[model samples]
Target: MSAYPSHPRATIGRYRNRGAYDFQAIHSVVNAAPVLHLSFIPSETDPFPTIIPLLGQMGSFANPDADPSSEPLDLYIHTHASTRLVKLVASQTEDGEKGLPVCASAALVDGYVLALTPFNHSCNYRSAVLHGYATPVTDEAERLYAMELITNGLIPERWGNSRVPPTKTELQTTGILKVTIESASGKVRAAGAANDKQDLENEGVIGKVWTGVVPLWQTLGEPVSNEHNRVPVPAYLDNWRKEANERGEEYAVETARKKY
Candidate 1:
Protein backbone atom coordinates (compact mmCIF):
# COMPACT_ATOMS: atom_id res chain seq x y z
CA MET A 1 0.00 0.00 0.00
CA SER A 2 1.12 3.54 -0.73
CA ALA A 3 2.15 5.60 2.28
CA TYR A 4 0.34 8.81 3.15
CA PRO A 5 1.93 11.53 1.01
CA SER A 6 3.40 14.12 3.35
CA HIS A 7 2.27 17.68 2.86
CA PRO A 8 4.71 20.55 3.13
CA ARG A 9 2.99 21.78 6.25
CA ALA A 10 2.57 18.30 7.75
CA THR A 11 6.27 17.49 7.46
CA ILE A 12 8.20 17.31 10.72
CA GLY A 13 10.61 20.25 11.14
CA ARG A 14 12.92 19.47 14.05
CA TYR A 15 14.33 16.04 14.76
CA ARG A 16 13.42 14.83 11.27
CA ASN A 17 14.80 11.41 12.17
CA ARG A 18 11.93 10.84 14.56
CA GLY A 19 9.18 11.45 12.00
CA ALA A 20 7.10 8.54 10.66
CA TYR A 21 4.37 8.37 8.01
CA ASP A 22 3.59 4.65 8.27
CA PHE A 23 -0.12 4.12 8.81
CA GLN A 24 0.21 1.43 11.44
CA ALA A 25 2.72 3.41 13.48
CA ILE A 26 0.61 6.54 13.27
CA HIS A 27 -2.69 4.78 13.89
CA SER A 28 -1.38 2.81 16.85
CA VAL A 29 -0.25 5.98 18.64
CA VAL A 30 -3.57 7.68 17.95
CA ASN A 31 -5.62 4.70 19.16
CA ALA A 32 -3.57 4.17 22.30
CA ALA A 33 -3.81 7.79 23.39
CA PRO A 34 -6.51 8.51 25.99
CA VAL A 35 -7.16 12.07 24.87
CA LEU A 36 -6.99 14.00 21.62
CA HIS A 37 -6.67 17.74 21.15
CA LEU A 38 -8.47 19.21 18.14
CA SER A 39 -7.79 22.70 16.84
CA PHE A 40 -9.21 24.71 13.97
CA ILE A 41 -9.93 28.15 12.70
CA PRO A 42 -13.52 28.60 13.85
CA SER A 43 -13.95 31.82 11.93
CA GLU A 44 -12.18 34.02 9.42
CA THR A 45 -12.90 36.92 11.76
CA ASP A 46 -11.73 35.39 15.04
CA PRO A 47 -8.30 36.49 16.29
CA PHE A 48 -7.11 33.21 17.77
CA PRO A 49 -7.54 29.57 16.77
CA THR A 50 -10.14 27.47 18.59
CA ILE A 51 -8.84 24.35 20.28
CA ILE A 52 -10.72 21.77 22.32
CA PRO A 53 -9.86 18.58 24.15
CA LEU A 54 -12.13 15.95 22.69
CA LEU A 55 -12.79 12.25 23.07
CA GLY A 56 -12.22 10.71 19.66
CA GLN A 57 -11.29 7.53 17.78
CA MET A 58 -10.12 6.69 14.28
CA GLY A 59 -11.99 4.19 12.08
CA SER A 60 -14.11 3.88 8.95
CA PHE A 61 -17.73 2.75 9.31
CA ALA A 62 -17.87 2.13 5.57
CA ASN A 63 -15.58 -0.79 6.32
CA PRO A 64 -16.25 -1.33 10.02
CA ASP A 65 -14.46 -4.64 10.21
CA ALA A 66 -11.36 -3.53 8.30
CA ASP A 67 -8.12 -4.14 10.18
CA PRO A 68 -6.92 -0.85 11.59
CA SER A 69 -3.38 -2.16 11.38
CA SER A 70 -3.53 -1.93 7.60
CA GLU A 71 -6.49 0.19 6.49
CA PRO A 72 -6.75 3.97 6.47
CA LEU A 73 -8.85 5.51 9.26
CA ASP A 74 -10.82 8.68 9.74
CA LEU A 75 -10.98 10.49 13.04
CA TYR A 76 -14.43 10.59 14.69
CA ILE A 77 -14.84 13.26 17.34
CA HIS A 78 -17.68 13.47 19.88
CA THR A 79 -19.13 16.78 20.96
CA HIS A 80 -22.29 18.55 22.10
CA ALA A 81 -24.43 20.58 19.72
CA SER A 82 -24.28 23.76 21.78
CA THR A 83 -20.50 24.14 21.79
CA ARG A 84 -18.84 27.07 20.00
CA LEU A 85 -17.03 24.62 17.71
CA VAL A 86 -20.23 23.13 16.37
CA LYS A 87 -21.86 26.51 15.82
CA LEU A 88 -18.88 27.92 13.95
CA VAL A 89 -18.39 24.91 11.70
CA ALA A 90 -22.07 24.84 10.93
CA SER A 91 -22.00 28.48 9.89
CA GLN A 92 -18.74 28.54 7.93
CA THR A 93 -18.43 25.25 6.08
CA GLU A 94 -19.62 25.21 2.46
CA ASP A 95 -21.74 22.41 1.02
CA GLY A 96 -19.17 20.64 -1.17
CA GLU A 97 -15.77 21.97 -0.18
CA LYS A 98 -13.76 19.96 2.29
CA GLY A 99 -15.77 20.91 5.37
CA LEU A 100 -13.37 22.61 7.73
CA PRO A 101 -9.62 22.46 7.79
CA VAL A 102 -8.49 21.08 11.13
CA CYS A 103 -5.59 19.58 12.99
CA ALA A 104 -5.83 16.80 15.56
CA SER A 105 -3.03 15.58 17.81
CA ALA A 106 -2.45 12.91 20.46
CA ALA A 107 0.51 11.93 22.63
CA LEU A 108 1.63 9.56 25.36
CA VAL A 109 4.57 10.33 27.65
CA ASP A 110 6.21 7.06 28.63
CA GLY A 111 8.97 8.29 30.88
CA TYR A 112 10.77 11.36 32.21
CA VAL A 113 14.36 11.57 31.02
CA LEU A 114 16.67 13.42 33.35
CA ALA A 115 19.95 14.19 31.57
CA LEU A 116 23.29 15.37 32.86
CA THR A 117 22.53 18.89 31.68
CA PRO A 118 19.31 20.86 32.01
CA PHE A 119 19.12 21.45 28.25
CA ASN A 120 19.47 17.73 27.49
CA HIS A 121 16.50 16.66 29.62
CA SER A 122 13.63 15.22 27.59
CA CYS A 123 10.85 12.68 27.77
CA ASN A 124 10.30 9.23 26.33
CA TYR A 125 7.18 9.88 24.25
CA ARG A 126 5.06 8.77 21.31
CA SER A 127 2.82 11.17 19.39
CA ALA A 128 0.81 11.51 16.18
CA VAL A 129 -0.37 14.53 14.19
CA LEU A 130 -3.13 14.49 11.60
CA HIS A 131 -4.07 17.22 9.18
CA GLY A 132 -7.56 16.82 7.83
CA TYR A 133 -10.90 18.29 6.83
CA ALA A 134 -13.65 17.80 9.42
CA THR A 135 -17.30 17.81 8.50
CA PRO A 136 -20.17 17.80 10.96
CA VAL A 137 -22.00 14.48 10.61
CA THR A 138 -25.56 14.98 9.31
CA ASP A 139 -26.70 11.44 8.59
CA GLU A 140 -28.52 9.78 11.50
CA ALA A 141 -27.17 6.28 11.08
CA GLU A 142 -23.63 7.46 10.51
CA ARG A 143 -23.84 9.57 13.66
CA LEU A 144 -24.85 6.58 15.77
CA TYR A 145 -22.16 4.42 14.20
CA ALA A 146 -19.53 7.00 15.09
CA MET A 147 -20.91 7.18 18.62
CA GLU A 148 -20.69 3.42 19.11
CA LEU A 149 -17.19 3.30 17.63
CA ILE A 150 -16.02 6.05 19.98
CA THR A 151 -17.65 4.40 23.00
CA ASN A 152 -16.02 1.09 22.16
CA GLY A 153 -12.71 2.85 21.81
CA LEU A 154 -13.08 3.91 25.43
CA ILE A 155 -14.06 0.44 26.58
CA PRO A 156 -14.37 -2.38 24.08
CA GLU A 157 -17.97 -3.54 23.40
CA ARG A 158 -19.29 -0.96 25.89
CA TRP A 159 -22.18 0.24 23.72
CA GLY A 160 -24.00 -3.10 23.48
CA ASN A 161 -23.37 -3.92 27.13
CA SER A 162 -24.78 -0.62 28.37
CA ARG A 163 -28.44 0.53 28.37
CA VAL A 164 -29.64 -0.73 24.97
CA PRO A 165 -30.03 2.46 22.99
CA PRO A 166 -30.07 6.23 23.41
CA THR A 167 -33.26 8.25 23.46
CA LYS A 168 -34.20 10.79 20.77
CA THR A 169 -33.48 13.70 23.11
CA GLU A 170 -30.08 12.27 24.02
CA LEU A 171 -29.17 11.82 20.39
CA GLN A 172 -30.39 15.28 19.44
CA THR A 173 -28.13 17.04 21.91
CA THR A 174 -24.98 15.20 20.86
CA GLY A 175 -22.89 15.93 17.76
CA ILE A 176 -20.15 14.02 15.94
CA LEU A 177 -17.56 15.24 13.47
CA LYS A 178 -15.86 12.98 10.97
CA VAL A 179 -12.39 14.05 9.88
CA THR A 180 -10.97 12.73 6.63
CA ILE A 181 -7.27 12.81 7.21
CA GLU A 182 -5.21 14.21 4.34
CA SER A 183 -1.65 14.00 5.56
CA ALA A 184 -0.38 12.59 8.83
CA SER A 185 2.73 11.60 10.76
CA GLY A 186 3.82 9.91 13.96
CA LYS A 187 6.92 10.76 16.05
CA VAL A 188 8.54 8.93 18.94
CA ARG A 189 11.45 9.16 21.36
CA ALA A 190 12.61 6.44 23.66
CA ALA A 191 15.29 4.09 25.15
CA GLY A 192 16.63 6.55 27.71
CA ALA A 193 18.42 9.85 28.21
CA ALA A 194 21.12 10.67 25.61
CA ASN A 195 23.65 12.94 27.28
CA ASP A 196 26.95 14.34 26.07
CA LYS A 197 30.03 12.09 26.17
CA GLN A 198 32.08 15.01 27.55
CA ASP A 199 29.68 15.26 30.49
CA LEU A 200 29.91 11.51 31.11
CA GLU A 201 33.72 11.72 31.17
CA ASN A 202 33.67 14.59 33.66
CA GLU A 203 34.07 12.86 37.05
CA GLY A 204 32.62 15.79 38.99
CA VAL A 205 29.65 16.04 36.65
CA ILE A 206 29.06 12.28 36.76
CA GLY A 207 29.21 12.28 40.56
CA LYS A 208 27.00 15.35 40.98
CA VAL A 209 24.35 14.68 38.36
CA TRP A 210 21.61 12.12 38.66
CA THR A 211 20.72 11.12 35.10
CA GLY A 212 18.04 8.54 34.33
CA VAL A 213 14.49 8.04 33.15
CA VAL A 214 11.57 7.86 35.56
CA PRO A 215 9.08 5.54 33.88
CA LEU A 216 5.50 6.78 33.77
CA TRP A 217 2.19 5.17 32.81
CA GLN A 218 -1.58 5.61 33.19
CA THR A 219 -3.21 3.15 35.62
CA LEU A 220 -6.94 2.44 35.58
CA GLY A 221 -8.38 2.78 39.04
CA GLU A 222 -11.02 0.46 40.51
CA PRO A 223 -14.54 1.07 39.28
CA VAL A 224 -17.07 2.34 41.81
CA SER A 225 -20.66 1.38 41.19
CA ASN A 226 -23.49 3.77 42.06
CA GLU A 227 -25.46 3.30 45.28
CA HIS A 228 -28.47 2.05 43.33
CA ASN A 229 -26.45 -0.64 41.60
CA ARG A 230 -26.72 -4.31 42.65
CA VAL A 231 -24.52 -6.16 40.16
CA PRO A 232 -20.96 -7.30 40.68
CA VAL A 233 -18.52 -5.55 38.37
CA PRO A 234 -18.78 -7.23 34.99
CA ALA A 235 -15.78 -9.26 33.89
CA TYR A 236 -15.27 -7.00 30.86
CA LEU A 237 -14.83 -3.84 32.90
CA ASP A 238 -12.70 -5.61 35.50
CA ASN A 239 -10.44 -7.18 32.89
CA TRP A 240 -10.19 -4.01 30.84
CA ARG A 241 -8.92 -2.03 33.81
CA LYS A 242 -6.35 -4.64 34.77
CA GLU A 243 -5.10 -5.08 31.22
CA ALA A 244 -4.93 -1.33 30.54
CA ASN A 245 -2.83 -0.65 33.63
CA GLU A 246 -0.54 -3.57 32.93
CA ARG A 247 0.04 -2.52 29.31
CA GLY A 248 0.73 1.07 30.29
CA GLU A 249 3.01 0.13 33.17
CA GLU A 250 4.98 -2.24 30.98
CA TYR A 251 5.55 0.33 28.23
CA ALA A 252 6.57 2.95 30.78
CA VAL A 253 9.21 0.70 32.28
CA GLU A 254 10.40 -0.69 28.95
CA THR A 255 11.01 2.75 27.44
CA ALA A 256 13.30 3.70 30.31
CA ARG A 257 15.81 0.91 29.72
CA LYS A 258 19.32 2.36 29.22
CA LYS A 259 20.53 2.06 25.61
CA TYR A 260 24.26 1.68 26.20
Candidate 2:
Protein backbone atom coordinates (compact mmCIF):
# COMPACT_ATOMS: atom_id res chain seq x y z
CA MET A 1 0.00 0.00 0.00
CA SER A 2 1.35 3.43 -1.00
CA ALA A 3 0.96 6.42 1.29
CA TYR A 4 0.54 10.14 0.65
CA PRO A 5 0.61 13.15 2.96
CA SER A 6 -3.01 14.11 3.52
CA HIS A 7 -4.72 17.39 4.27
CA PRO A 8 -7.37 17.72 6.97
CA ARG A 9 -10.15 18.03 4.42
CA ALA A 10 -8.63 15.19 2.37
CA THR A 11 -9.63 12.48 4.84
CA ILE A 12 -12.38 10.15 3.54
CA GLY A 13 -16.05 9.81 4.51
CA ARG A 14 -14.75 9.33 8.02
CA TYR A 15 -11.23 10.00 9.26
CA ARG A 16 -11.26 6.31 10.16
CA ASN A 17 -12.23 5.19 6.64
CA ARG A 18 -8.90 6.67 5.44
CA GLY A 19 -9.59 6.22 1.74
CA ALA A 20 -6.73 5.32 -0.58
CA TYR A 21 -4.15 8.14 -0.44
CA ASP A 22 -1.67 6.80 -2.99
CA PHE A 23 0.14 9.31 -5.20
CA GLN A 24 -0.10 7.03 -8.26
CA ALA A 25 -3.90 7.18 -8.14
CA ILE A 26 -3.75 10.98 -8.19
CA HIS A 27 -1.06 11.16 -10.86
CA SER A 28 -2.66 8.56 -13.14
CA VAL A 29 -6.03 10.29 -13.45
CA VAL A 30 -4.36 13.67 -13.89
CA ASN A 31 -2.06 12.37 -16.62
CA ALA A 32 -4.72 10.35 -18.46
CA ALA A 33 -6.81 13.45 -19.08
CA PRO A 34 -5.50 15.91 -21.71
CA VAL A 35 -7.11 19.16 -20.64
CA LEU A 36 -7.85 20.70 -17.20
CA HIS A 37 -9.90 23.64 -16.09
CA LEU A 38 -7.80 26.13 -14.01
CA SER A 39 -9.77 28.38 -11.69
CA PHE A 40 -8.37 31.38 -9.81
CA ILE A 41 -9.68 34.57 -8.30
CA PRO A 42 -8.42 37.64 -10.12
CA SER A 43 -6.59 40.46 -8.32
CA GLU A 44 -8.94 43.02 -9.78
CA THR A 45 -12.24 44.19 -8.27
CA ASP A 46 -14.40 42.16 -10.62
CA PRO A 47 -16.71 39.52 -9.14
CA PHE A 48 -16.38 37.01 -12.02
CA PRO A 49 -14.28 33.83 -11.83
CA THR A 50 -11.27 33.23 -14.13
CA ILE A 51 -11.35 29.86 -15.84
CA ILE A 52 -8.66 28.76 -18.33
CA PRO A 53 -7.89 25.58 -20.28
CA LEU A 54 -4.55 24.25 -19.04
CA LEU A 55 -2.11 21.61 -20.29
CA GLY A 56 -0.66 19.63 -17.34
CA GLN A 57 2.70 17.91 -16.73
CA MET A 58 2.97 15.34 -13.95
CA GLY A 59 6.07 14.14 -12.08
CA SER A 60 7.32 13.30 -8.61
CA PHE A 61 8.37 16.13 -6.33
CA ALA A 62 12.03 16.87 -7.09
CA ASN A 63 14.31 19.73 -6.19
CA PRO A 64 16.68 21.55 -8.59
CA ASP A 65 19.18 18.67 -8.20
CA ALA A 66 16.42 16.18 -9.23
CA ASP A 67 16.23 14.39 -5.90
CA PRO A 68 12.75 12.84 -5.65
CA SER A 69 10.82 12.97 -2.38
CA SER A 70 8.55 10.21 -1.15
CA GLU A 71 6.44 12.28 1.21
CA PRO A 72 5.93 15.37 -0.94
CA LEU A 73 4.65 15.46 -4.56
CA ASP A 74 4.88 18.25 -7.11
CA LEU A 75 3.61 19.00 -10.65
CA TYR A 76 4.32 21.67 -13.27
CA ILE A 77 2.59 23.38 -16.21
CA HIS A 78 3.26 26.21 -18.73
CA THR A 79 0.96 28.74 -20.33
CA HIS A 80 1.05 31.86 -22.50
CA ALA A 81 3.17 34.70 -21.13
CA SER A 82 0.48 37.32 -21.56
CA THR A 83 -2.38 35.30 -20.10
CA ARG A 84 -4.47 37.35 -17.69
CA LEU A 85 -4.72 34.44 -15.25
CA VAL A 86 -0.94 34.13 -14.89
CA LYS A 87 -0.54 37.87 -14.42
CA LEU A 88 -3.02 37.88 -11.57
CA VAL A 89 -1.21 35.04 -9.79
CA ALA A 90 2.26 36.61 -10.22
CA SER A 91 1.23 39.82 -8.45
CA GLN A 92 0.88 38.38 -4.94
CA THR A 93 3.94 38.58 -2.63
CA GLU A 94 4.89 36.37 0.35
CA ASP A 95 4.17 38.66 3.30
CA GLY A 96 1.53 37.55 5.81
CA GLU A 97 -0.71 40.31 4.51
CA LYS A 98 -0.31 39.27 0.84
CA GLY A 99 0.87 36.03 -0.72
CA LEU A 100 1.06 34.32 -4.10
CA PRO A 101 -2.34 33.78 -5.72
CA VAL A 102 -4.01 30.58 -4.65
CA CYS A 103 -6.06 28.05 -6.56
CA ALA A 104 -9.24 27.57 -4.54
CA SER A 105 -9.84 24.18 -6.13
CA ALA A 106 -8.44 21.98 -8.95
CA ALA A 107 -10.30 18.88 -10.04
CA LEU A 108 -10.36 16.03 -12.60
CA VAL A 109 -13.48 13.88 -13.24
CA ASP A 110 -12.47 10.57 -14.88
CA GLY A 111 -15.86 9.02 -15.76
CA TYR A 112 -19.58 9.11 -15.17
CA VAL A 113 -21.30 6.68 -12.77
CA LEU A 114 -24.85 5.37 -13.09
CA ALA A 115 -26.69 4.01 -10.07
CA LEU A 116 -29.60 1.57 -10.54
CA THR A 117 -31.00 0.86 -7.09
CA PRO A 118 -32.84 3.37 -4.88
CA PHE A 119 -30.98 2.89 -1.59
CA ASN A 120 -27.71 1.31 -2.84
CA HIS A 121 -27.71 2.71 -6.38
CA SER A 122 -24.82 5.03 -7.33
CA CYS A 123 -22.70 6.01 -10.30
CA ASN A 124 -19.06 4.86 -10.26
CA TYR A 125 -16.44 7.61 -10.42
CA ARG A 126 -12.80 8.53 -9.70
CA SER A 127 -11.79 12.09 -8.89
CA ALA A 128 -9.15 14.22 -7.14
CA VAL A 129 -9.24 17.81 -5.97
CA LEU A 130 -6.27 19.86 -4.74
CA HIS A 131 -6.12 23.02 -2.69
CA GLY A 132 -2.86 24.89 -3.16
CA TYR A 133 -0.97 27.93 -4.48
CA ALA A 134 0.89 28.42 -7.79
CA THR A 135 4.55 29.36 -8.09
CA PRO A 136 6.13 30.94 -11.17
CA VAL A 137 9.23 29.35 -12.72
CA THR A 138 11.78 32.14 -13.19
CA ASP A 139 15.03 30.24 -13.73
CA GLU A 140 16.06 29.56 -17.35
CA ALA A 141 16.89 25.87 -16.89
CA GLU A 142 13.74 25.10 -14.91
CA ARG A 143 11.57 26.80 -17.51
CA LEU A 144 12.99 24.57 -20.26
CA TYR A 145 12.33 21.45 -18.19
CA ALA A 146 8.78 22.63 -17.59
CA MET A 147 8.27 23.01 -21.34
CA GLU A 148 9.61 19.51 -21.93
CA LEU A 149 7.21 18.15 -19.31
CA ILE A 150 4.25 19.87 -20.99
CA THR A 151 5.13 18.59 -24.48
CA ASN A 152 5.74 15.05 -23.31
CA GLY A 153 2.51 15.03 -21.35
CA LEU A 154 0.50 15.55 -24.57
CA ILE A 155 2.43 12.94 -26.63
CA PRO A 156 5.35 10.86 -25.41
CA GLU A 157 7.31 10.83 -28.69
CA ARG A 158 7.19 14.58 -29.36
CA TRP A 159 10.62 15.29 -27.88
CA GLY A 160 12.33 12.67 -30.07
CA ASN A 161 11.23 14.31 -33.36
CA SER A 162 13.21 17.52 -32.84
CA ARG A 163 16.99 17.53 -33.18
CA VAL A 164 17.35 20.96 -31.61
CA PRO A 165 15.81 22.25 -28.40
CA PRO A 166 14.05 25.52 -27.68
CA THR A 167 16.18 28.67 -27.70
CA LYS A 168 16.65 30.84 -24.60
CA THR A 169 14.74 33.67 -26.28
CA GLU A 170 11.74 31.40 -26.75
CA LEU A 171 11.89 30.27 -23.12
CA GLN A 172 11.94 33.82 -21.78
CA THR A 173 8.70 34.75 -23.53
CA THR A 174 6.83 31.70 -22.18
CA GLY A 175 5.16 31.69 -18.74
CA ILE A 176 5.40 28.57 -16.62
CA LEU A 177 3.69 27.86 -13.29
CA LYS A 178 4.39 25.10 -10.79
CA VAL A 179 1.50 24.08 -8.57
CA THR A 180 2.47 22.37 -5.34
CA ILE A 181 -0.56 20.41 -4.24
CA GLU A 182 -0.59 21.30 -0.57
CA SER A 183 -3.70 19.33 0.36
CA ALA A 184 -5.57 16.82 -1.79
CA SER A 185 -8.43 14.33 -1.70
CA GLY A 186 -9.23 11.25 -3.77
CA LYS A 187 -12.68 9.63 -3.96
CA VAL A 188 -14.12 6.61 -5.75
CA ARG A 189 -17.62 5.15 -5.88
CA ALA A 190 -17.79 1.72 -7.60
CA ALA A 191 -20.93 -0.14 -6.59
CA GLY A 192 -24.07 -1.38 -8.29
CA ALA A 193 -27.45 0.31 -7.85
CA ALA A 194 -29.24 -0.93 -4.76
CA ASN A 195 -32.90 -1.73 -5.43
CA ASP A 196 -35.06 -3.04 -2.62
CA LYS A 197 -35.94 -6.77 -2.79
CA GLN A 198 -39.61 -5.83 -2.82
CA ASP A 199 -39.08 -3.52 -5.81
CA LEU A 200 -37.28 -6.29 -7.72
CA GLU A 201 -40.25 -8.65 -7.12
CA ASN A 202 -42.80 -6.19 -8.49
CA GLU A 203 -44.39 -7.59 -11.70
CA GLY A 204 -43.56 -6.02 -15.05
CA VAL A 205 -41.62 -3.17 -13.37
CA ILE A 206 -38.16 -4.41 -14.32
CA GLY A 207 -39.26 -5.09 -17.92
CA LYS A 208 -40.68 -1.57 -18.36
CA VAL A 209 -37.61 0.27 -17.11
CA TRP A 210 -34.34 -0.19 -18.98
CA THR A 211 -31.91 -1.67 -16.40
CA GLY A 212 -28.42 -3.16 -16.62
CA VAL A 213 -24.80 -2.18 -16.63
CA VAL A 214 -23.76 -0.07 -19.64
CA PRO A 215 -19.99 -0.29 -19.33
CA LEU A 216 -18.11 2.76 -20.66
CA TRP A 217 -14.72 2.81 -22.30
CA GLN A 218 -12.47 5.00 -24.45
CA THR A 219 -10.72 3.73 -27.56
CA LEU A 220 -8.61 4.92 -30.49
CA GLY A 221 -9.97 5.16 -34.05
CA GLU A 222 -8.49 4.52 -37.50
CA PRO A 223 -6.30 7.34 -38.76
CA VAL A 224 -7.47 8.95 -41.98
CA SER A 225 -4.57 9.68 -44.28
CA ASN A 226 -4.29 13.18 -45.63
CA GLU A 227 -5.53 13.59 -49.25
CA HIS A 228 -2.31 15.30 -50.36
CA ASN A 229 0.02 12.96 -48.54
CA ARG A 230 1.90 10.24 -50.45
CA VAL A 231 3.56 8.36 -47.58
CA PRO A 232 2.27 4.99 -46.31
CA VAL A 233 0.35 4.83 -43.06
CA PRO A 234 2.63 4.34 -40.06
CA ALA A 235 2.84 0.93 -38.38
CA TYR A 236 1.66 2.34 -35.02
CA LEU A 237 -1.53 3.65 -36.63
CA ASP A 238 -2.05 0.29 -38.42
CA ASN A 239 -1.87 -1.48 -35.06
CA TRP A 240 -4.61 0.75 -33.70
CA ARG A 241 -6.79 -0.11 -36.68
CA LYS A 242 -6.21 -3.82 -36.11
CA GLU A 243 -7.24 -3.50 -32.49
CA ALA A 244 -10.38 -1.60 -33.47
CA ASN A 245 -11.32 -4.33 -35.96
CA GLU A 246 -10.97 -7.03 -33.32
CA ARG A 247 -13.33 -5.15 -31.00
CA GLY A 248 -15.97 -4.87 -33.77
CA GLU A 249 -19.40 -3.18 -33.61
CA GLU A 250 -19.60 -2.92 -29.83
CA TYR A 251 -16.59 -0.62 -29.82
CA ALA A 252 -17.91 1.34 -32.82
CA VAL A 253 -21.29 1.89 -31.19
CA GLU A 254 -19.71 3.10 -27.95
CA THR A 255 -17.53 5.56 -29.90
CA ALA A 256 -20.60 6.87 -31.75
CA ARG A 257 -22.62 7.21 -28.55
CA LYS A 258 -19.97 9.51 -27.03
CA LYS A 259 -20.17 11.97 -29.92
CA TYR A 260 -23.72 12.97 -29.02
Q: Residue by residue across 1-260, what tens digits does model 1's lDDT show?
A: 53466898878899898888888878888888889999998767879987899899988878988677778888999999888887766765665666788899999999999999999999889999999988888899889999999999889878999995899999999988888999998888877888899999999999999999999999888898899998999999989999999989888888799582
lDDT of 2 by residue, 18-67 (tens): 25466665665566556666667774688876767787765543453332
In candidate 1, list every pair of residues with a backbone clash.
Answer: none
**Residue 79 lDDT, candidate 1, scale 0-100:** 96
In model 1, which regions exceed 4 Å deviation?
258-260
| lDDT at residue 241 of model 1 (Cα atoms) | 93
The whole-model lDDT of each prediction reads: 0.86, 0.57
Q: Which candidate number has the best lDDT?
A: 1
Measured on C-alpha atoms, candidate 1 has an lDDT of 0.86
Candidate 2, residue 212: CA error in Å? Answer: 2.5
Best by TM-score: 1
